[model samples]
Target: MRLGSLAYEQIKERLLEGGYGPGQRLSAVELGAELGVSKQPVMEALRLLSADGLVTIIPQVGCEVARYELQEVQDFFALFASMEGTIAGLAATRCTKAGLRGLDAVSARIGHLASETDPVARSHHYRLLNREYHARIHALAGTAVVGEISHRMWDLSDFLINTSGADHPLHAALDARHDDHETIRKALWDRDAGTARREMELHILGTLSVMRPQQL
Candidate 1:
């Protein structure tokens, strides 16, 4: 990959994975040194991330991770829930045997997280596995346009959840989240469109409960 794209992916990955906190200052020179690149490509990456609402760049003040207000976060999740619910509905009818099996595989890994005692590891691992579990459902939907849009939304979802000033956000809700997954899995397995859609929306909006209200 080009240096600029590489920088973008690296930076964006950190942002989604909670390496950077909301509104934390980022130094291009420091990041360049870390990535073995230069300031130019680092700045290029920041600009791209800014366009995706993950970073904010100021002319004189430099760049920091993006932060959203409580209402904005809630609104984003609401929209995200609607789209994902639709996808789950489509996935209900479009799911192939192989796709459902793949989803179950991911969910099995998530189930294992309950035994993971380390807070950071459990939270991080759950975040990633939770994403794959949903991505499997997305693939089953066989959507091209909305699936593309949902991918970006998923990034933002991770960003908000991780940066909401809650330490171990996913850890706090691990058991509940796993239970939600089981409910979703059963609906998908049964090919119940209504149940899948309803369960998905509730599961996503459930994110708000664990988020810190003060920092949101």
Candidate 2:
């Protein structure tokens, strides 16, 4: 990867891991020093991060990690739920036998990892499994335009969920979310578009409960 791309990935990893808190100011000079690169690469990385919705760059005030308010989170989740539901509905009829088998294998791996004792291990496994599962649906849905938009929304959602100030123990709800996968899987297997869409919509919206509502 080029220096800018490498910087983007490294900085994005820090953001996802909560190394930088939401709304925290970022210094390109400091980041460049730390990453052993010139300020140009850090600037490029920050621009990319801003485009990805992980950071906010103000013309006069500079950049800070993106801070998502409760309303913003809810709105984004609603949008994601609608889009993903539509995708699942399409996938219900579009997925080939081989694709269905691949999804089943991913579901099996997720089930196996759901019982993991180590918090880190469990989180890591679920992240991988969740990404793979949704990616499969995107492919099965077979619309590049929708898939591209969905991927961007998912990326933004991941950022919001990971960096939000709410300490609502979202991790604890992982098993419940994973369990919904079974319902979705069955609907897909049955080629029931309505059920698949409903199950997927419910599962996506369920994640909204992970965030605690702000005080009025």
Candidate 3:
């Protein structure tokens, strides 16, 4: 990979993993030291991440992790759920038998995560595994354009979920989240597009509840 791309991926990884908090200042010089590169590449990376809505770059103030208000987060997830529901519906109609098996494998891995003891580790791994589960659905959708658009949104979703100022986000509800996945999987296996779409929408909106444990 190119230097800029490498810097971009590493920085984005930290943001999604909660290595950086929402609105936390991101010093390019410090990051360059850690990445063993100059500030230039890091700045380029931040700029790209900014475009992805994971970072905020202000001309005079420098860079920071992107932050959104509570209402913004709510609005984002609502829009996100609708888009993902559409993709799930597409996946239901178009996925091959082999593709369905691959999805089952990923879902099983997520199920295993339910037994994990560490909340932080479980949340981190769940974020990754959950992405895989949805990415499999995106692949089954068979539309590169839709997949590309959905993926950009997914990146933002991760940044929001992991950086939502909640140390235990999705940590306490592993079983419920896993149960949501099972229902979606069964719907997909049955090739029930209507059920898949509705189930996926409900499952996604449920993310807000986990994010705010008070609701859980």
Candidate 4:
């Protein structure tokens, strides 16, 4: 990748990791000097981040991180739940034997790691397994448009996941989510498409319950 693209990825990672808070100004010259790069690459990176809604660019004031309100987070999750349900429903009918096997493997790994003593590492492992399982389902759905939307949602989800503190109820809710995934998998394995679809929708709604007033 070019220097600009490289800078873009690095800056994006920092933003996602909460290195900068909402509305914090990003000084291109300062950042460039700090990172040992030229201002041009930093400026290009800021523009890309702005395009992704991670930053806001003002002509005179330069760029600042975008602030997300509680309502905004809820709205994003609502949309994500709906889309994920649809994808899961479709995937139930479309997944091949190999696809189902892959999902099963991921779920098994998650189950194996559930007893780990380190909460942080356990959470990270669960997130990785969850991503792999969902990606497999999306691929099986065979809908390009759905896949594209899921990708965008996944990006936004990174922001939510990062901000959802370790104490969030969502952590406990994830156990229920694992069970739901297993239920959906069983339905798919049995070739019961309707059951699979209903299970997925319920699962998503169940997960949404954890994102309440405080955690938003």
Candidate 5:
């Protein structure tokens, strides 16, 4: 990877891993020192992260981690649910056979991870599998304008999920998510657009319900 890209991933990983708390100021100089890179790459990485809504940059004051309010979190997921439902419907009719296979593979991995004993490993693997499942659906949806918007929304949702952390027990959340994915997978495989849309909508709203009341 290029230096700036490498620095961006490393720094974002730290933020997701809880190395920095919400609204904590980030020093590019110190981050660069820790990351063993020059300030230039670190600053570039910070700018990219800022665009993703994970960081806020002030012209004179520098940068700090971004924080989300409960209503914002709720609204984000609600919007995602609507968008993803449309994507799911599109995938049912538009996704190629190869795309279906890819979605199946991701679902299989999620099933395996759901049985995993280690919470940390399970959470990590589930994130990758879940992301791929939705990303593929969005890509195959074939709606240029909405697809681009969906990607941005997914980015924001991902940052929130990683940084805000889950409100429910890890295992329970995994199980619930796994079940939802199974239903969505079946709908897609059967080319049932209406079922896919309904399942996906329920899946997202169900997730919101499982979250801690405070988080909502």
Candidate 6:
């Protein structure tokens, strides 16, 4: 990759990792210097992020991180829950034995990491495994549109999860999210489409219930 592409990836990771708080301004010059790149690539990257709704581009004021209102978060979660539930149901109907085995591997890794003593490390590991498991489910569904939408929603959710604070009190619910994954996997293995869908919805709704009140 060129320096521009590298700069783009670096900045994208920072935003995705929650380094920039919601509505925080991103200075292209400063960011470029920090990343040891020139302003041109930083500018291009900001444009891309702005297009993705991860940042706002003010004509004269430059770019700032995008912030979500309370209702927006709620709506996003509801939509995400619906999409994921449908995906899970479809996955149950479509998943092959090989796909099931892949999901099992992800679940096992998550189960092992769930017992970690460090909350931050545990959260990180949980998110990684969660993404893998869900991605596999989406792949099994074989719906391009659904997969694309789910990926976007997940990007937003990732922003929220990473920035929500060290002691945000949602950590407990996040810990329980793994258990929900286990239930979902079981339902899929049994080829119970309805159960899988309902379980997935409940899992997302539970996440919304836990995190909504604490959101800014």
lDDT per residue as tens, model 5, 1-216:
999999999988776544576788999999999999999999999999999888999899999998989888888788889888988999899988898898888888788875688867776677667778888888667788887887677666656765665532335588778888888888888999999999998887676665555576
lDDT of 3 by residue, 7-98 (tens): 99999999888789878999999999999989999999999999999989989989988888888888988999999999999999999999
The 10-residue segment with the lowest total lDDT in model 4: 162-171
Worst 10 residues of 3 by lDDT: 207-216
List clashing residue pairs in candidate 5: none
Error of 1 at 103 (Å): 0.8
lDDT of 6 at 175: 54
Score candidate 1 by TM-score against the native.
0.96
Model 1 bad stretches (over 4 Å) = none
Error of 6 at 24 (Å): 1.3
Instruction: Rank all candidate structures by their TM-score, best first, as comma-separated numbers.
Output: 1, 3, 2, 6, 5, 4
Which candidate ranks first by TM-score, i.e. highest?
A: 1
Tens-digit lDDT string for candidate 6 (118-190):
7666666666667888999998888889899888778777776665553433345655877889899999999
* Better structure of 4 and 5 per TM-score: 5
> How far is 52's C-alpha from truth in model 1 (Å)?
1.2
TM-score of 3: 0.95
Candidate 4 regions exceeding 4 Å error are: 17-20, 29-36, 165-173, 205-216
Please identify model 6 stretches exceeding 4 Å from their true place. Answer: 166-171, 210-212
Candidate 5 positional error at 211, Å: 3.9
Candidate 4 residue-wise lDDT, 4-39, digit = tens: 898888887676554676778899999898778999
Model 4: lDDT equals: 0.74
| lDDT-best of 2 and 5 | 2
What residue pairs are clashing in model 1? none
Give the per-residue lDDT digits (tens) of candidate 2, residues 14-125.
7765568888999999999999999999999999999998999999888999987777878888889999999999999998989989999998988887567776566656
Q: Under the 3 Å rule for N, CA and C atoms, how many clashes does model 3 have?
A: 0
Residue runs of model 5 more than 4 Å from their true location after superposition:
165-171
TM-score of each: 0.96, 0.92, 0.95, 0.81, 0.88, 0.91
Q: Give the alpha-carbon lDDT of every model.
A: 0.92, 0.83, 0.89, 0.74, 0.80, 0.80
